[model samples]
Target: MLLLELVETTQTVASTRSRLAKVDALAHLLRRLDPAEIPTAVGLLSAKPRQGRVGVGWSTVAAAKEEPAAKPSLTVADLDAGLDRLLATAGTGSGAERAATLRKLMAAATAPEQSFVTGVLLGELRTGALEGVLTDAVARASGRPAGAVRRAAMLSGDLGGTAMLALTGTEAELDAVGLVVGRPVLPMLAATAASPSAAVEATGEASVEHKLDGARIQVHRAGDDVSIFTRNLADVTHRLPEVVQVVRSLPVRDVILDGETLALDEEGVPRPFQETMSRFGADAVRETVLHPWFFDVLHIDGQDLLDEPLSVRIEVLERIAPAHRIPGEVTADPAVAERVSQDALAAGHEGVVVKAVESTYAAGRRGSNWVKVKPVHTYDLVVLACEWGSGRRTGMLSNLHLGALDPTGEFGEPGGYVMVGKTFKGLTDELLRWQTERFQELEVRRTAGTVWTEPVTVVEIAIDGVQQSPRYPGGIALRFARVKRYREDKAPADADTIQTLRALLRP
Candidate 1:
């Protein structure tokens, strides 16, 4: 398949707002892909390369300038070669040298091709379609059921590999082949129920676990050797030496456990999420304050418990896992679960996760087997303006200026609005680009390079709570306010009233 073919599909998908249509279009393209072309195709579709905040920018015009002596341009083979060279030079060169090499390779391609390469580098290809959509596409192309394709990919964490296997044989045959190969497959992470009623509806009986505020970790131990990794699969074995020591002491050998790593206070209460993140940088490994709490075991002693039900896995986890676990879990009663939720909040924890007893580990699927119940508070808000971002967010209006929604539905008048804060969180890069373009189209004022947008995106803000503010019209401010999602389904006229804000004011 030509790179242009994939690029056209991406452009079409990026322009479309209807997700179902996007999925259908992607599925059609996948069906037409040659089996041998799947790996390069997937690689092209998923590359997300990002430059740092500093350095020269590359626009179409910029790329056209200072053209090199039309040397033989990059091909698929060149991409592979470039990646090999990058890996070879990875830890040996200065950051600038690596960045320059990556930039040169990226510039050698056309715009769409550059987009593809960038996506691969950033580890996320936000073409508006997720794994399920891609799975459907693969199954349609390979003449297999979507469920089988999804399961195989879940087991392998490599969609291209799964697609290859599915095209050639049955899932059972693939599983047997996988066992023989003995390569580490994907770990099955816990899923969540979409709603409280969904949690009850899924399992006939529901159990609740305190949803501690921490980072998700997967620990793999073989004899005395232990490795700890974050949810994104980046190895952090050296960063948390204390946690590694704890895992090494567990009696079991050859086990994989899933849990949270937190920073705890003197009273054993968990520290803030930022504190845990602080222990992740280049110098973090030497810090000793990080603590871990093991919650589930997906594999132990060569027995893969992923196929087993949650209750069964919990039994195995309790038996072979470490004695120290996240404290205070209540089961089978919503009333008691509510009390536990209250206790968790009082103790400075996040909230509770109510899970179904019989739910199996659904790798990469947000299935309705677990439900997170966080305390929701509402804030009246106004849209100020959006800001441009760097790196993966280049040329995009990636951050928002948020203000309390004036009860009077007025701006610039007395007590009309308050500029509380700004946030770039909760937005995927694709969303950033879309918002940037939209903001430009809706620009009401312009200053320097910044454009003030029409206050059209009305949204309700949720946070842990509010804090006193020197800024903001309501004399209080939102804590950790982020775009939960665009309120496109909602009109500004329907925004939460100031009375709601008054009710939530801290005494």
Candidate 2:
């Protein structure tokens, strides 16, 4: 398959809001791919390369900008090989050497191909065909059940690998994919509810656990060795030695635990969300201590608990790590669930997550099986641009211009975004300095005081609610919006949509 074809399909997907159309076009393309091209093609389509890191920065891409080739020639293998070269050459030379390599690769592509490659490399692709759409497309192309494909990918913890199998392997092999001690399955996500009572009412006979404003962790233990992965499946065992020690101390061997970890103040209270997330970075200060609190057990003693009932998994979790478990109660009463939520708030936690007692873990999907209730309204929005800071924040990219996804093009181009609001609140000195340096690497355009970037960075914004506004394209603006934390785990496509925020206006 030609790289041009992939580029065209991406444009086609981005050009519309109809998910069915996107899946159909992608499926048509996938069916034509040679077996060897599936992984590379899947990676490009999803904007998450299998190589894990492309290492090409915005400046290198800018330096490589020139007249594109006249005709199409590069194959999928050719593009894959070029990306491999970029990955290989990273960290081995100066910026000029990397720039030269990127220039050579870009010189071989047409205009659209260059843009597509740059978008994928910089983690800024605007294609609306996220994993959900791509998974369906894969199933459509392979003539397999979407559930089977999703389950295989979740269990194997590798979408690219799953795509390859779905295309070339049998259904039996895909079904055989199961939980492995070292492999991290995607963590299950919760849908949002207006209140704890509402959530409990929705999921009857629930385990309502305190929703900690902490980082999600999936810890895999094999004997004494333990590995901790973030919600995005990035391994951070070395960065979180304290967490590793805690999981390693669990009595049972070969267990996979799903939980939350956060930095704690001397008062034994959880620190701010950013403080806990800062520890995940490579250059983070190591003084703060992090603590792990398990809430669910996925596997223990060679038995997989993913398909088991939540009640059964809770039994295993309580037996193995009761001391480390998050505080909550198992109750069917909405009033009891409401009390748990209030207690969680009084104890300085986010809220409560009500989980159906009989529901099995559904990895990588957000459904009503588990519903979270937080008092404050928070939405994950993308950083569309950053304005130069004034006052004490001068010379820093302090004020952020935020946007929400307009997925169906009701307010804008299909799959494009609509600017909703801007806020400079909740930024610390360290965060301002970090943004000043980091946003430059993602820069795409700029004005005298603002630097526009690829809509890749997702930030969680706490808002009072939305108010009617004509200043923004979406016709609604964030009320009392402030940054809570930068969501490095989420993709731009995963950010909350404009429609969702506007729906908040409903009485």
Q: Which candidate is the best by lDDT?
A: 2
Question: How many backbone overlaps does candidate 1 show?
Answer: 15
Candidate 2 C-alpha lDDT tens digits along 244-296 = 88887878879999999888888888888777877766444498888899889
lDDT of each: 0.61, 0.86
Poorest 10 consecutive residues by lDDT, candidate 1: 48-57
lDDT of 1 by residue, 67-89 (tens): 33233355554665555555555
Top-TM-score candidate index = 2
Cα error, residue 484 of model 1, in Å, equals 13
Error of 1 at 208 (Å): 1.2
Q: How close is candidate 2 to the true structure, as a TM-score?
A: 0.94
